[model samples]
Target: MQHKYLPLIIAAALSAMSAGANASGYRFGSQSVSAQGTADSNAAEANDATTIFYNPAGMSRLDGMQISAGATMVVPHSTFTDSGSTRFTHTPTGGTAASDYVPSQVTAPSFYLSKKLNDKWTVGMGMFVPYGTKITYGNTWTGRYALSDVKLESVTLNPSASFKLNEQHAFGFGIDAEFMKANLGQAVDVPGSVMALAGTPNAAALAKQIAQLGGNPALLGTAKDAHGANDGKDWGWGFNLGYLYTLDQNTRFGLTYRSSISHQLRGSTVWDFSKVTTDPIVNGVLQAASHKANSAALVALRTPETLSANVFHQFDAKWAGMADVTFVRHNRLGDLDIQFPGTAEGAEVIRQQWKNTVRVSLGGNYVYNDNLTLRAGLAYDESPVKNAELTHPALPDSDRMQYSFGANWKLNARSSIDLAYSFLDFKDAQINYTNACNPLATACTGNGETTRGTFKTHLSLIGLAYNYKF
Candidate 1:
């Protein structure tokens, strides 16, 4: 009797909360097309309405009503090569390693609007994607037990207000409302769970059957490899602050801070047991233990906060330069925990132990003519993972460099267009993770499995936007 339904025994590959963002950790990073024209170093420029995201105080500099809309295209490539991966039984996990995981390219969008209520006060709003990702690996990869596929996304809406205290000083505040969703999938070991029942009642017969069937290598885990998947969505809130200081008509400095947001993703877990052995004894025992069709699941997490500083200077009619620095408090993602009800192992944890990080950027602009301007920049971004030991298949992070360039076209006195491009290369890094099953659970099946491998990677971004002054 070949049965096709079974519950989970141990969830080794649980979650990678910070899995698929273009920026370090879970942030999309590129929020504005004009900003990307200078490698994202335009915080003090306040030339467009997008200032609502980077530095709201800059909004006070806008006249009348202004709006900006844009979109970015992100293409990523990820490949994995296994060094030494094994099953819970200490046997080699027989399978082909993944050459590439990210199936294709992705696109993100943004919009901003600002209204100068008076000479001293300005109000604005922004709707943009702050975090998002999409990556998939083959189901039979060497690290199948650790990660099979993952997709995550988030959107934030910000309503801001700014006050011009004087000719040289301005302050801004905003309310941040965000929503996030995620889905993660991985493979399960049914034979491993059966073996966990060894020495118990009616177990001698099952053991003999397993050993006899092992004679044919083709049937090894084919009929016993199950699957586990989880999906959920949630909403969170936070705040932001911005300040702009103008030392003179030719120079300006901007500082901004974003607060952290906490969220509890509520979802459910589904297990597939459609390929279990036909043996009644084998099927009955496995089904009778820790079996459930579905169960409630929850994951508690917090996004990180950031502090950014920037200076923009105009040297001449054809010369301008800017520099920016940002500090990310990624320590907020220390330990990620998940809860699953009606299971032997009711919960699982993936230790991140992430560290704080920094990003630095420099850029320059030149006016080729009255209606055209060219932009270029370079930036260095750091990852939060301390080392390979803490890296996971979900988020194989590393330090990287951003190379960017773009241009601006002023169509007329009230309208303009911006186009930018960037290429990012992450320093090579490794993933070293141990078995994730909690042996202490009553009916666990983890046998000290480990996944150690490296992933292939590539990233590029192209942004386009239109700005209007009404």
Candidate 2:
């Protein structure tokens, strides 16, 4: 567990670069219980207050005051098998393959309240988790250097208003207040860094120190139980707009747009070397590194914007159908850059270069009786990560299909309950990522170490919501 001099360098790198993307795979898609039942395709048919999050314009079609509260439980599973992974020394970084790095269950919650002021005015507020994810790949995983643990979460509060232009048109706008929290973790290959430091001025001194701790080449791939991590939080602002156009009582269309948000998270670097420190070398290195650093770290982050269109049609007295198409401008997060206030380390970067993405869904509802309705839906989700080489373990995202089912039970004139279940089937994805072993390197997928593998993953969601009308 004792280290020589490289842990200090990796500590600085981890502190500066504290952000990464988890994208569609971990994007907290179950925003509403009602919407989840329809694979989020019922935007034009917003029947409850949750419409405030999807398409506020639909609020114009509601009666009086209404409220909705819900929560969804996400269950995920995954396994990764290594094919060919090598380190900065071009030696095999042999370690255990990962399995179910993400937790078995994660809960996402939402709330909404809407009020109809008059025939032409409607107002509402909504709170929800738009993006969230947490992962732990163990210390000895094949891709430990690239990533071992990652936790990121965001919450949004939206205050919205809508106006009914006439029986045929409505418009809505909302302002968003978002909060973000992030934690990033990885391993610092102590033995492997011996090679990365080959030409550095401190090379000789470092090698002498390592040799004192039994410099063993066999320890190259055998990572110590050492783990490094950093954390930060911030707040950002954005806005959204929606429009609903009614063709007739039985048919309607909806359009919505959400703006992007920019955030700067400021934090100081924190390091824990206890697990890797039985010798005084690690402590000495830390003290020296501390004297030279005079700055806090800052991570710049950008959330993508999105546009969507939807249609709802009534086929008969007992049948209805809906569909939705959405565009996600993920390219806005092409890269994550971090800087130190008073250091020459320049900037550390994780080259995501994510591309834009699209999602499509279709759903249907059957009115079984005066108080019950059954729903079923299907959807396709695309990943913004286009190149396999860019794939990293922090976010095991990929293309997938979603199948959903649910029911709505009207309890009385003023109350109802919604129940839903959904399953995501992801395509087997490949990981061909390379992680830089040092801070001075510059490459989208790293140039020093490569982790090659195939990943299999999937998820399920169960949600429940209660709705009330005044």
lDDT of 2 by residue, 195-215 (tens): 556667666665455567655
Best by lDDT: 1
lDDT (tens digit, per residue) of candidate 1 on 356-403: 889999998999998999999988988888977777676777888889
Flag regions of model 2 displaced more than 4 Å.
Answer: 1-26, 195-203, 207-226, 286-295, 436-447
lDDT of 1: 0.74
**Global Cα lDDT for candidate 2:** 0.72
Model 1 pairs in collision: 1-278, 4-273, 4-274, 5-273, 6-273, 79-456
Model 2 compared with the native: what TM-score? 0.88
Identify the leading candidate in terms of TM-score. Answer: 1
Prediction RMSDs, each to the true structure: 5.1, 5.4
